[model samples]
Target: MLTINNLSVHYGGIHALKGINLEVPQNKIVTLIGANGAGKSSTLKSIMGLAKASGGSIKFNGEDIVNKPTTNMVSKGLVLVPEGRRVFSNLTVEENLFLGAYLRKNKEEITKDLNWVYELFPRLKERVWQKAGTLSGGEQQMLAVGRALMSKPKLLMMDEPSLGLAPLIVKDIFGIIKEIHRNGMTILLIEQNAKAALEVADYGYVLETGSITLEGPGKELMVNDEVQKAYLGEHK
Candidate 1:
């Protein structure tokens, strides 16, 4: 659903991306796995126009969306759940969730999507009226994902959803990712947790520094010697 071709980015003198090429096909989960500062987040940011693209094109569906306004992403059926769960601390949980659908005027559909989000995350439902800052980290992450879903996007891009969380909660988050994929949500996932990300991805890319080093079927990449040695923490 999204295609990035020869995309590059620069922040002053630092060339953060080196003409990386990637694609997220319809109804498929694609992952970019790399270490910190590997330009994984830059790729997503460029797509969302959060970071400026220094060169090349980003095609959503079929049209080029390289430098479009970030505000238009949702209406085009694209959404991003950023690396940090940036929930509104002062807003109640329900208020934060409703804010996700603020762009839309379909009140009934918004309410329906809100209930679905609550169902997907029962904890958020339980804390519906509570201050967002009071929720645990995992709950905040769920809130972020749930908020993104409120837009009813065709393509969902998530950056580092499992960062700084407990292993069990990470597992739960991956399970939720799988569940969302099973229901046909196209996902472009950026993760440092290669094992979990690749295990869930339909396809995977290994990014190094600022370029794509390897791309393959998710299971194939999982067993690749280079992937194992570097990202998967396996010797030999």
Candidate 2:
């Protein structure tokens, strides 16, 4: 449902992304796995128009959206959860979720999605009135995902959903991602946790120094020698 071709991004003279070509099929989870400075997050940001693309195209469901403003992308059913789970700290969990649907005209649909979010994340429902900043790291991440779901997006781009959490919590988050995918949300996942990400992803891409180095079915990539050596911590 999303296609990025010959994508490149530069910060003044520093090149952050160099010719990243990737695609996420509809209703499937696709992961971009790489180490730090590999331009994984930059690819997601470029899709949301948060990062200015210096070259090439970003297409969402066949529409060119390379340089579309972030809000426009949101309106077009493309939303990013971002790397840090940047929730509104001072807002209550419910308020944060409400803000996510602010652009929608269909109040009933928003209410339905909110109920679904609550059902999917009972913790968020329990802390509905609590300030987002007061939630634990895991809870905050749930809130972030719940808030994004409130947007009712066709494609959800999440950058590092399990960045800094306990192993158990990371598992919980990935489980939720699988649940989200099962519910028919197309996902473009950027993660450093290659093993876990690939386990849940339908397809995977490996990026190095801003370019795609390998692409294949997730299971295939997980067992490949190069991927095992570079990402899976396995010796040849």
Candidate 3:
């Protein structure tokens, strides 16, 4: 559903991404797992047009999307949950969700999508009128994912959905990610938590220092000697 070719990004003199090629197929979960500073988030930012690409191209549904306005992205079926679950602090949960569907004029369909999001996250349902700023970190993350789903994206790119959460909450988040994929939402996941990301991904890429060093089936990468040693904390 999404294709990236020879993608590169730079910040001043720092090269954040280095000629990385990646793809996300329809109805599948693809993950990029790496350490901090590996440029995983940069890839997502580039796709969203939040970050400029120094070189290469990004395509969505076979059309070149490089350098398009971020506003144009949602209409073209692209959405990002973004890093850090950046929810609107003063907005009610319900209001935050509605903002996601602001571009759509069909009220009935928006309501239906809202109901689906609430069902997917019963916690958000319980806090419908509550302000997002008061929510816990895990709940905020759920709200971020829920808000993105409100856009009805064809491909969802999430940046570190599991970051800084408790282990149980991280597990819950990954479970929901799998459920979303099972429901036929294509996902491009960027995760520093390699084990959780790979466990649920159909395919995985190992990125290091702005370049992808390995790509394989998620399970295969999970067992790769280098992946084991580096990300999974295993030694042979």
Q: What does candidate 3's lDDT look like per residue over 30-96, in tens digits? A: 9999999999988999899999999999988889999899999989989999899999989999999
Candidate 1 structure quality by residue, lDDT tens digits, 24-109: 99999999999999999999999998999999999998999998999887789889998888989999999989888878889999
Off by over 4 Å in 2: none
By lDDT, the best candidate is 3
User: TM-scores across all candidates?
Assistant: 0.98, 0.98, 0.98
Q: After superposition, how far is residue 146 of candidate 1 from its true place, in Å?
A: 0.3
lDDT of 2 by residue, 37-85 (tens): 9998888888999999999998888999998889999999998898889
Q: Looking at model 2, report the run of 10 residues with the lowest lDDT sum.
A: 227-236
**Prediction 3 global C-alpha lDDT:** 0.94
Model 1: lDDT equals 0.93
Q: How many residue pairs in model 1 have overlapping backbones? A: 0
Residue 117's lDDT within candidate 3 is 95
lDDT rank order = 3, 1, 2
